[model samples]
Target chain A: MSVLLVLLIVFGIGIVGFFIGRQRASARETGEVKVHSRAYYHGWWVFLVSVLPAVLFIVLWSAGSSIYLERSAQASLPAQTAESAVASRGLALSMVRGIATGLDRLDAQELQNLPQSYADLRSLLGSKGVALASEGQDYMVPIAERWHSQAATARTIGAGLAIALAVAGVIFGLSGIHPRARARNNVERIVLWGLLAASTIAILTTVGIIFSMLFQTINFFSVVSPWNFFFGTVWDPRFADAGSGGSQGQFGLIPLLAGTLYIAFVAMLFAVPVGLFAAIYMAEYATPKVRATVKPLLEILAGIPTIVYGFFALVTVGPFLRDLSAAISGGGGFIMAQSVLTAGLVMGIMLIPFVSSLSDDIITAVPRAMRDGSLGLGATRSETIKRVILPAALPGIVGALLLTASRAIGETMIVVLAAGVAARLTVNPFEAMTTITVKIVNQLTGDLEFNSPQTLVAFALGITLFFLTLAMNIFALYIVRKYREQYE
Target chain B: MNLMTERSLEKAVGDKMNAVASTNKMKGDKVSVFYGAKQALFDVDLDIPEKMVTALIGPSGCGKSTFLRSLNRMNDTIEGCRVTGQITLDGEDIYDPKIDVVELRARVGMVFQKPNPFPKSIYENVAYGPRIHGLAKSRHELDEIVESSLRRASLFEEVKDRLHDAGTGLSGGQQQRLCIARAIAVSPEVILMDEPCSALDPIATAKVEELIDELRQNYTIVIVTHSMQQAARVSQKTAMFHLGNLVEVGETEMMFTTPKEKRTQDYITGRFG
Candidate 1:
């Protein structure tokens, strides 16, 4: 429902309640019988009181209720269907778990045991009803079966409570905007706090992400010293004991960090000049009609999802780059599908709009008077723009470039797909590389052992990425503020 | 005549007459102006003499400033403003396509009502025109031009030591003098002052008036002022414009003491400015 419509309804109710309350009090205050407040204030106060709780409840319910409903609907299936479904689902779960544990991969019989074991479990669970009826048992079942039944019951109840709680939230939210509401003032306060909170959220989230990584990194450092992670040349993060049964890992992070920076730098080199020039043309040279058509078209580039860009990089840019590198290098050892250049070019395409839109705004904000003043001195239009307007807007443009740099550094998907998983610290754009984010995804996707060096290294990489972006943002903001002060 | 009809008639006539008159040995003539659909100057006729200060004194909305702007073609920059009548400098049509506006503006310089010295050092402000127009070939020549211009404006004594300070950092009177110095640096034949001392105090006004007398020996000056006393004190020729028409034009002493038109007399006597 529209927020305005909701407020109007609440206001109507509040007005009616206010008159009723005022009428009750008026007889006591004034013998001749008058309303307690100016009719509007009374109406406003009543609306203010009821609407807040109603709105809060509605918002909470909207966000949280649907998940509970899906579970509840699952739980309330018919008894026969439930028994059959649970048996089949249990069979499926065991199969998944068996594959996950690598148990089924051991031998032919072990793999073949997957189907047999599932059938046995299914028959065992499904036969419980017959056994209970035939044995004439009222409530005495085996402890294991009883425990399972209790668990199922508890799941159902939990699902119902979640649904009800969500519904209750909706009711409370709607009630907030009702006639006796104090919500106008409450909402105003919330909006003010919300704006402050939103600004804080960016900083807080950065800190939270960094800390999450730091804690895990600390765990990694406990096993391998910090010095090895920071400076060791080799990054063989798979150190398996020869006599032992499982995975091996080594924890050198320098190669990965170098690869990340190299790829990011290459991407910026591709993006910055093209984006800045495009921004200058759009802001200063283009007519309004052309700008209106082109600006949104540029923004559309930004609107495309990163995942889509990643796919494009993989399917299109990768092969094209590989062929081009082969042609350029005369087929020596320059395979280019998993190269820094491929990732940089794709990432540059992703960043073009980010840089252009920001710099365009900064350039456009340059005052018209500066241009006029120069032109008045008989300077040509281009000369005026070059000497006066560009110089004045330079600091702001630098800030915009810094923001784009931060975005480029933090980007993950394009780098992941086009820039392959070979993490070699090479300056050559034709060489394959990996970034911190791609490594983090690889480390955490499987049945991750939290304390293992491989898993813990992901966290350390995340911390480094977070700090770099945070520093970029803070410095960019400082430069932009200082530039504004100069003009003002 | 009423203001509206006078403007409407001027708009109908156009700027060709002013152009022809200018080329035929008149300094400035027949200038008509329009701001969008509303006309401000009629096909007005006037001759501002060489090497003498000409005072244009009239009631508000009498097209005095409009006519003043036409002398230098400053009205060309105002959006939706159209000038139909011609104006000339030294028997050359200023509005002619062949005339370069930049060169014309340098030849016929103007100082506005407000003291608009650029936000720069006083020396730089004075040097702006000379540097841009390539009037001074070297640093020594530029320095000489700047010193002479400031001396001519009578601002050299007060600001000689602080030539590097921002012009805007000076007091209002000093800034006005600085602007005058800046205008004179280009060494134009005609100098247009639009209520130059209206923003200055009495002492500054007297100083500027004295400087105007001194400037008359070398340049033709046209001053637009509201003050009758200042007009009487500074000008040799006075042109009284009323309702966009030139009511009377003659020697300043003769026009003031014995105006031929009743409107001119009424205005000069301070009945209705």
Candidate 2:
């Protein structure tokens, strides 16, 4: 919040300075003008001179004062508290953390005990002076008392300097903004820079996130070889020492990867045709009456929460599929409670509107004359639609499908709740399976181990998932470009 | 005159002199057009002819295009555009329960003001009709049909070699010719041209006018035009529509030279439309 305030103040100062400087400059430019430059330029010059130096001073002083305050506070500590070097350093660090986070809550008893502990430690370490100070202690008492007061004084002075800089900036800024002011242009430049800064911050944040993941994944890769992590057959995240333990644990990603692909493939199989057909029906075949009624009904599917889909998969589709599978196979357990089929089916339903809406927009964008050209030639309506409309809208539809795939790949909560914990490498949709996201949750939810392969593997999987989606996005973009070129 | 042209002229002028008089000249008796409950054409009554290219000319917002569309029931495709009209193609009521719209459109083909060509080869553009209608049995038969249609449209000599290229790559006039060829490939009895030369240059307009004269030999043509000169050049019979009413209908030369109605004379003499 203070950072924002500082920027706002600086901007105001710059604007004010511009106007004052412009007025001065304006007067100078014209023979009738008393000053050497435009009035607004003169105002800007004065504003820059007045505010910039003070802002710079405040920034330097505040940064320097923090370190100075901390060091002074430490140095002001009595010989009793410093006798034990490690203890004193730990206390100092804790004190700083407390100030920063507001987390340190020392009760009256604790505070009392701290001074006594320091005194005892001082005596034990053969330190001489016996000094204990309270917040109420006067400045004339001793070095410790004076130190505390000075620290408080420094904070107050730093705050006052900040306020003074801000006030000076505001006054100069207002004084500069007159009738002949160039303050608006100065404001515009500041706004442009502010936008640049904001975008840079967003980019820097993304880079920071990526590097943070990369470092942890590098740690994970050191513990588990990259080849084994990428291509091993089994997926057992648990690691047991073979020398001490009765049985060794397995760790392989093939099952998870296979499960994810199978689930997503099933989802796409259900989603693409249904969604695209819906889009086609809406865009081409349906009358206005039917379209008006049906379009919103279909779009309403997009608004339903994915969590609701998860519940539906768990409670409704799971049982339905189980019964259907049993009827077909003459057995009940062929359809597990948390089977890929249930999750895939529900996810497909959830994704229908996303695909349909996007594809509908693209399909509708196709010129009506394309259909007319075919229809005018005595082609049946269906024939025209199949040959002309579908072919023209194919690229956009494919792009929508790829985007749906990316959504399915990154889907976390639905799969976590509905997809089973078991990871199996199989094509049978009835079988239970896990995905990368589910495994990441399982590994990282509890007490985190920075060095453990189990925990670090989550970051590795995250990076892999990121790349997968990145590839999908690029492919979608390529298709969109290709489709645009066809029309253009 | 050819066998078809002579028969059509005799049937149009002789059989329908005062066919139904004031009410029956245009046999669109039960016409009712709806654009989502906003009726654009209301029970329209008019007479269309056999051999002549009847020009349906009117000011803007007069439902001229709507009435023109109802001739072949083209309004059927527009959503919520319900029509209840007894439109006939050569005395056979087109809006009958049994008449197929697909066949009706093929029988009464249309050309829009804008030259809309398919993003396909010029050959494909001409061949699309015969291929769908199965007018030709072999590639050779199809090729001959395409050539004749293009020739009839007066575009064969210019575009014969480049028929393999996209139809849309042609110039505006050439594209319109390509569209005409496409329309002619099906060999419809009546060709409806909705201001065909509106998007063409003067030279292209002359070429299209010359083609229209040649095509008048076989096909009964209905044209909608904003230009009176275009109507005078191409049309044999003229129908003047205003505010969704048939203001006048007469032979083109008589209508231009000596109109009976004051509005018609005023319109011809460059007065307010």
Candidate 3:
């Protein structure tokens, strides 16, 4: 039986169990003693009990049967095929499974009158839409018949077991639906476990990603010395010919690191004051009508995709800056079309909402009494905000800015489109530079050998970027927590 | 409106009896206040005598705090709050267009119900007002003003050694006193206190009451209190309010002993709020 059919049968059983449990509990409610839980709770409790274990069994059975079929086919392999490489052995097993599936589609008369020769069997299976890659051997026909029978038996046993479990679960669940049964508690515990499992999956996925990248990064370090990869200034990872011994170019991290930091620094320098002023205006000075309209309009800037911003940079802002520079200098422009300034400017615009929205919330959280105290002391509104409100919200604002800085460092789409992929160690903001994320994308794209240091170096760069942002986030969290205790 | 006119007529008679006793320092003439569309204070007239603690006592939501906030124009900070009629300080209409609110507030400082100290060193909290107003010319002079203001607030002895510590680090009573000192640093002609001791324990409340009585000798003070005993203990004159109108105004002893208005009598006797 198909997995979906089994699942549907189990769900139908659960629905029946729900009604039975609810009816039993309601019947008990007619007595003098009151039911501990509501009828709905009793129904849900029965549904969970009937459905959860059966669905779990069906899933495991389906997974286990596939592994068993593959192993049996591997054991039935001919001596010459078994002695072949692992890749060929895998290919042969897939062909065996395919022939088994094709045979199941044939009628009883066709199965009884099977082809005897290898070529004839191939032709018959091919006619049935199962195209085998290699020439078939003489032992394949018998093995395909055997594999088909085993798969059928496995499916039959699995369907029988799942149905039995579901029926037993319904009986056991209805038996517990008495007046004093703690149905609600049981259902609530199941919900708690479900939520915990969801969060655990998310956390486990993050850990799994880190470990996968860590192993590849270790492999890359084995090829390139850590000292050279970290401290080297040049980032000339020349693409060597595949499978040919040639020069593996330098993979210095300094220029990329400098570009990342420099661009982020410039973006912060542009964003902080503007975003902070906007936040102050929204939180302190604007009337409710004006604030209600302005806040969402600013958030709309955040809703825009970064790739669209990249397109804007590539098509409009970069050229505009270059032309403006050319007009002033009266020569080939000193500023390149794709330069650090272009990327930083666009990235700064993207980060404004990040800083403003967070800082606006933090500033508004300062008690209204604080404003009154300052105004009561004869300070002007500006004076009150300067000495009282801003100082109170400083730590939270710092944390917000740190988060914005991390976002700027990790930004790739705008930099890839606006900033040229030139790894240069320069301080000039008008010149082109590249960051770590841009280099990671460059190294991994296109056809390349997986074992090459060029591709493996992407993993190293990814882990480095991860740790850099991780440290900043941790520091920001520490600052936010330490100062949050002051007001409350 | 009829009830307001009748109460004001009674208040007029009381004012005439005390006219010769003391000159008016700050006078509210038929003042009314509105928040959005809701009228919070009706046409009310009262006078704050100079260098005396004139307490405004009323039940919750009776507009006593509203009246006190209007004296210093603190209500202007609240959006949609409106005040009409006249409030004059030393014979000048404070609501006149020519008056600068910042300067007017400099002459009339206020303390709120809750202690709200700036998140700064205790020294900065007091010096903030003087520094902004340029009341002191040099660092030494600013120090002297800070020290003398803290002294007048009666918190100098407790906080003199840790003047550089955060004002928010103080206890509830100390924080309230620190706020009082910050207000005093501006050297305003009048001081408004809105339930200043409500957040304190009994012992702290008693200390603050004693400080208020001492402060009356230097500045004109108007205090709003829920506790009738606090009004009687710390104020020279007491004004009773009910439902946004002034029920009676008289000497503290007479108002407590034999109130002319039944509302004031019932309230002071704890018959009902």
Candidate 4:
């Protein structure tokens, strides 16, 4: 049975069961709140009973049947084709499955009158707007026929078992409805488990991703020594396939690490003061009309896609800096068009909203009482803000800065477009440099195979980047939470 | 019944405590207050005499706090709060356009209902006002001011050891005293307290009441309080207000013992507001 059809069937069963159980509870109810549980609880209890088991069965059946059908189809392929089919069983099974679905689209009369040859069958299916793989041979047609029959059998068995369970569940739900059954408590327990399962899925997926990256990183480390990856000053990933006069593979992370930090530092230096002063002005001095208009306008910078910011830096800021540098030098531009300065400047602009919004909230949260106390002491408004409000808001602002630093460090698109990918270990902001994220993209994009040191190194860089941001987030949260506790 | 209350109020005012009263240090001549378009105080006139504790006692929202805040121009901080008529200190109009509000506040400090200590060390809290107003010539002079303020607020002995401790970490009563010290450090001519004991326990209230008594020797004070007994205990003079009306004013003992206004009598005897 189709998954959507199974869901519809379960919903229909739940509705039927709800009415039956609701009727039973109402028939026996003495007055409102007199029963052990509410009539709605009794109805929900029946709905859960009728839908849950059948849904579980449908999920398990679908999973089990797909694996079983593929294995059986691969087993039944002729010995001559079996050797090749074993190597590409996944692809072949998908093709076989497609043909099986196409057979279903043809009713009994059309299917009986179908051509024996695969090309004729393909043409016939094409006229019906169902295309098969052109490589499907005459011998494979019989296998496709078998696949269709087995799929029908599996659907029948699955639907039969699901309907049987749903019926049994309805009967059991009806029998369980009594005055003292505590249906609400049962429902509550089931709901708790449902929520638990949902949260567990989120946590488990993160763990799963981390573990997968960990194994790949372990593999990459086997080829590249951890010492060289961490402490070496140069970066050059070259192999036989690396066209255009490439150097032999020498993976050094320090240049990328330095570039990342230098860019992030420059971005933060630009962002923090500008953002904080804007926050203070907005929070303390701006009129309500101005604040309401200005805050969203400032935040519109945040909503613009970083990719757009990337090219904006590429086309505009990069060229502007290059020309300005050339004009100052009086001969030629030493500053490259794509340099750390261009990326850092634009990334800082992107992060202004982040810092301002968070710092504004923290500054605004400093109690009115604190301001009042300072003002009542004969301190001017500016004096009060400087002495009391900023001091109180400092910890949360530091947290916001740290979080923004991590965002700058991890950002890929802006770096990729505006900061050229040379991976040079230069401190001068005018020179070209690349970050870990851009190189991670560089190593992994296009038709690269995953097993090589060149490709697997991306995973290693990925885990390193993850840990960097993770450490930043943890430290930021600690400072932020400490600030909150002080206020309380 | 309400007519009789107002009639008695007028008769009592005609026969009230103008005889042998202390000279008024700060006086309001028909001071009326408005917040936006709504009237909060209706042509209310009152006197705060020098070196005396005068308490404004009234039911909530009866404009006594508004009247107290108006004395020091504390209402100036509030948006849309407007005050009319003359409020004078030493016979000079403090609300004159030439009169700086900041200097006025320096001369007349305020303590709020809730204990609002700055998020700083206790020592710094007391020194803040003095330092801001440039009252101290040196660090030693600042230290002496802080010590004297804390001593006068009666918080010195308890907090002498941990003067570096955050003001917020102090107990509720201690925090209130710290605020009082903060107010006192500026050595203002008048201190306007808006229900300083409202958030305190009975013991804290007693400690603060004692502080107020001792403070009356130096600064003139106007206190707005809801407790009638508190008014009876700490005040030398008492004023009664109802529905933004100043119903009566007299010496504290006379007002409690023989209030001529029916509204004052009814309020003191636990009648409805």
lDDT of model 3, residue A49: 94
Docking class of 4: medium
After superposing candidate 2, which stretches have Cα over 4 Å from the reference?
A1-95, A99-204, A241-252, A485-488, B1-39, B42-44, B82-85, B138-140, B156-165
Error of 4 at A474 (Å): 0.4
lDDT of 4 by residue, B1-273 (tens): 222244435533432444245688998889889999999998888888888889898889999989888877778777789999889999989889998878888888899999989888999999999988999999999999999999999999999999998999999899999999999999998999999999999999999999998898788988999888777767778899998889999887678768999889998877966
TM-score of chain B of 4: 0.92
Q: Give lDDT tens digits, candidate 1, residues B120-209.
A: 588988887787778998999999999999999999999999999877778878888887787888888888898999989999998998
Taken in order, the candidates have interface RMSDs of 4.4, 2.1, 1.2, 1.6
Cα RMSD over interface residues, candidate 4: 1.6
Ranking by lDDT: 3, 4, 2, 1
Candidates' lDDT values, in order? Answer: 0.69, 0.73, 0.89, 0.86
| Top-scoring candidate (TM-score) | 3
DockQ of 3: 0.63
Clashes of each: 43, 35, 0, 0
DockQ of each: 0.13, 0.37, 0.63, 0.52
Question: What ranges in model 3 sit over 4 Å off?
Answer: A82-87, A94-149, B1-20
Q: On a 0 to 100 scale, what is the lDDT of residue B55 in model 2?
A: 79
Query: What is model 2's DockQ versus the real complex?
Result: 0.37
For model 4, the local distance difference test gives: 0.86
B137: Cα error in model 3, Å: 2.1
Which lDDT tens digits does candidate 3 get at residues B1-273? Answer: 121234434543554455457788999999999999999899889998988789999889999999999998999989999999999999999999999999989899999899888888999999999998999999999999999999999999999999999998999999999999999999999999999999999988988888987897788899999997787677768889888998899877668767898888889888878
DockQ-based ranking, best first?
Answer: 3, 4, 2, 1
